[model samples]
Target chain A: MVQASSQVWSQQIIDDIHAKADLGRYRIRGFSTFQKVTHFDDLTFLSTGLTRFPLEGYKEKCSTQVTLGARYASEPLVLETPVYITGMSYGALSVSAKTALGKAASMVGSASCTGDGGMLPAEREASDKLIYQVLPSRYGFNPHHLLEAQAAEIVVGQGAKPGTGGMLMGVKVLDHIAESRDLPSGIDQRSPARHPDWLGPDDLAVKIEQIREATDGRIPVSVKLGACRVTDDVKLAAKAGADIVVVDSMLAGTGASGEALLDHSGIPTVPSIVMAREALRDMGLYGTVSLVASGGIRSGADMAKALALGADACAIGIGALVALNCNRDIPEADFESEVGVSAGQCHHCQTGKCPVGIATQDPELEKRLDSSEGADRVANFLNSMTMEAALLTRSLGKGDVRSLEPEDMVALTIEASAMARIPLVGTNKVFGWD
Target chain B: MVSLDAHSLSARELNQAIKKAALTGSQITILNPQARHNIAVGILDSCKIDIDGSVGYYAASLMDGPEVNIDGNAGWALGENLMSGKIVLTKDAGASVAASMRGGDIVVGGNAGARAGISMKGGTLLIGGNAGFLTGFMMQKGRIVVCGDVGDAVGDSMYEGVIYVGGDIGSLGADAKIIEPSETDLIELWGLLEQSGINDRPRFRKIVSQKKLYHFDNLERLEMSAV
Candidate 1:
């Protein structure tokens, strides 16, 4: 008799069920998506051969400069590079990590964002340009901080967990974190998924106006959404007076999110970007409101692909953490003793025992990461990515990164072709382009 | 004293002018307010603002330091998210008044609509007349005093706050119970009543949170039941 394999009852599924049964609790983790899905790698750039002339790499110049919030604000955020740092709160990461990210952003002439826990003074002081986040919970929100920010992002949802609220475990809710959020220490903090002030799109308009008034129209206001209903949400955000719309896809990282939400919610980044661009174009708001694409963007090639798909800029969160040595190899004994797992195999950010010290508040563990060293590493990573994107732009015979349009790319797979609205390789047929 | 007419200027221009005057600590007064919304919103400086007529939504919202006196009624979210200021409404106020206020004093001389003082952090809300349903809903840390009767579901899902009612309360919300007021609470209530210029002080019942909600054990049970 031949041995049989069961597809319905896989080993991984059985292990997961047994783990849940033994623990009697839902699993929590950091980062996102170990499952393979459609991504930017499925698309290939059509470099110059006959139709266009390629620029010289060393002598010729391809500008990477991008400006956000140009439509509404008197002072828009002008970035030297198209890459920006996405929001990651202080409670989720150590102060040293926040400071390092801020310093690196300043060094690269880009903007760093504050997350749901509010602005950290050290981050604000280190960064030359900062975007403040106003989340649904409004934790640690201050009108003065809004005035101080260079730009503001009104967060409707996060990519990893779209409909659910945020959770900070008791271990992460230390005294300072609790005080900042105005909650008691040693208790789990669960933030509401929806804003208490407004209910729908019309109310969102009023809230946007209120924020505009608060800032005296000096800074731009952006609306961020999880990539679920990309087209309709983008249209609504544009109509609601958003100067910029950020689409965070399912591949985005989180500090502390439920396992089910991270795996099962929101859409993929590639299709989300295409849908958002189409929506804005249909509404005649493509150029009026700048679009930012984020979630699982790991390299300069990905950045270039997103820009070609109509994103004015790209944001990186987990990639930035990895650049800051989030999973760097350490001594196995130390890793095992501290986190109960090897360095590269750890995802226990909710436990607050991060081995690499990038996502922890413990005093001893935090001391392992030096702010200057971390900043230098991140700055080098960003600079290299920018260079790669410039190379890609020059090869496509484009003088500016933003000029590499959708016509200059082709999809390697049918699903990618359908989702990105581009023609598949060796064929003139563009799927789903009707 | 500087007087401006709301009918003559747009809301933006009027607010800019008000901010300019407030920078020098001027006594500003407005005429024909005509239920204008967002009047004097986001004012950060200390100034005395007198509105002769009714105002609309978010009057004095995000105000840091200012004394606003509204002679007529106010629309929804009066003094919402106020920080270190005082708003005195001489007539009825609309729903969600003083919602999410951080630190300030909001006084309503007449009835207040539903959801007053919702998610209040730290402030004093004194209602001279009846308060509608869901008063002090999700209150974090603040003091709400209703001199008149209160409607149903007072202090719903409240985490930590103090609610005092002079008249009858229709129903207590989940995780809320009537408790005896401490000396400090009594003194605070009396001071608020005096500041609001209410002469008749009825015997008030204090309501506080039972601290039952917001635990992981309860949340796990809810998740299990849902499954």
Candidate 2:
């Protein structure tokens, strides 16, 4: 091939953008298609479910607008996209990390959630729409704080370790976190698994009512649940009058807690989405309440896949933290030496002594992170994911991210295929398909 | 003496009296109270409430600013979602005594039921006697102290908080540890006992979680790793 001038190459790149001015309908065939298969012709079905069938007479219809973004289970709270961030506790992350996540989520027009560790003034300052989580640990809970929490979530459970309490190690407990949580500085903070009131569903309803009355019905309330009996729990939550339901998967990120990591319960994200959809449909509350799925969603494709499986959106905790330069700038050898893991296995961030120091509370180590710059990186990553999602939607012949569906995905695991009750890619039969 | 027991008074009427007094600014003293769930639920104003007898569930759920005292035993979630106020139980308390309480002080003279002080965010829970199973199970912030024995699964999934127990702990639940009580814990517990007029602070064994087991599962093999 003949070498082209640098100017010509630049022009070609510009021309590519113009040529595909509407990149929504463009596909990359195998990689972008369901099952990663080349034989598939209907990419939309692979990405989004029947939503891509564009209502009949589309050519005659002038307005064919789809509800773009994630819908909340509660009436008033829906997000603009199917990709969002999960709650990462203040005690688990440094102030800089919390600030960075808040700023980026704000920039992305998505809500950032605060974990049970309590709200950081920095987080509140950086974020506009904050989703305050009320977990088994009622840290940072007060009338004034409740008033400030415009969006509230009752965390019934998380996927990483369902039915388990949480811990903020003394190592991560700085003076500020300690004071906010009213614990001895540098002492372990233990949170119980169950909420004090309402042992089961019936009690849960009463608690929900109490919370609603506490907020004077101004804020939308949702329930965050782990993906265990996802369908049943989702239905229960809907029956309990939840505005939104968050389903966290087993593989979702944990700051530390290697002990918990070694032993805990939570379902994977993919199966959880299907279960949630079924629950919502059974309850006749689909699209009425928002469904946010979380766990191991690393990219826009993963988010798109979840939406297709019937989730309104996906929330990412580990992915966002990782994108915030968590493990950056450190050599593989140094990481291995410091964290006692090889480069590839360095994801054991549960120790809180991050080799890069972004997740640690040690003052000397925390200095390594520049909050503003880290925030920019997170924002950039979110923007990048948005672009990728848009491109995937376009390629799948849909205009919005919701157009993506389980039909666009093929089971990477047989168990996943069974749990999701979806067909395996390149196959005509599902687990019980006749 | 108005023998207005919680059992006789409707949840609405009983609450109405407390609400009216709490609103119009008057002290409401109740005698022989019983099972009056939501007795002073969501009280926003400051008032003195004295219940001479035992009361039912959610005795003062979501209390904002009030002082409630129960002379006898109380039921579950006595101050379930308390935001502010002071609740004192002269006798024992039922399970989940102070679940998801935001801010407040709950002092129980006798033992509390299972899951007492579960998910307490901010507040102080002082139990002069034993505490049943799962005490401070998932408490985020705040302080919980049991002057006597604490039942099994104490501090099961706790994220943040300190638990001081004077007697033997049945078992250390998930993520929970047995540590030396800190100076602050000692001082705080003493102050709370004094504040609640309990006046009995003995050498207590401190049960804490090191935050290593951030999650738990009955299926998975438990790992006792200290990070």
Candidate No. with top DockQ: 1
Give the Å shift of residue A43 in candidate 1. 1.4
For every prediction, compared with the true complex, DockQ reads 0.29, 0.25
Q: What shift in Å separates residue B3 of candidate 2 from its native position after superposition?
A: 19
lDDT of 1 at A229: 98
Instruction: Encode model 1's per-residue lDDT on B98-194: one tens digit a residue.
Output: 8888888999999999889887878899999999998988787888999999999999877787899999998998888998877777777777687
Model 1 achieves a DockQ score of: 0.29
Query: For residue A34, what is the lDDT in candidate 1?
Result: 67
TM-score of 1: 0.93
Ten-residue region with minimum lDDT total, candidate 2 chain A: A27-36
List candidate 1 stretches off by more than 4 Å: A1-5, A22-25, A331-333, B130-134, B148-154, B166-178, B182-184, B200-203, B218-227
How do the residues A338-361 of candidate 2 rate in per-residue lDDT, one tens digit apiece?
Answer: 666554456544455666656677
**lDDT of all predictions:** 0.86, 0.69
TM-score of chain A of each: 0.97, 0.80
Per-residue lDDT tens digits for candidate 2, residues B98-210, read 88777778888888999888877778888889998988876777789899998899998677777899888999888789898878868877776777677777777787777
For A354-427, candidate 1 gives per-residue lDDT tens digits of 77777877777788888989999999889888988999999998889989788989999998999888999999
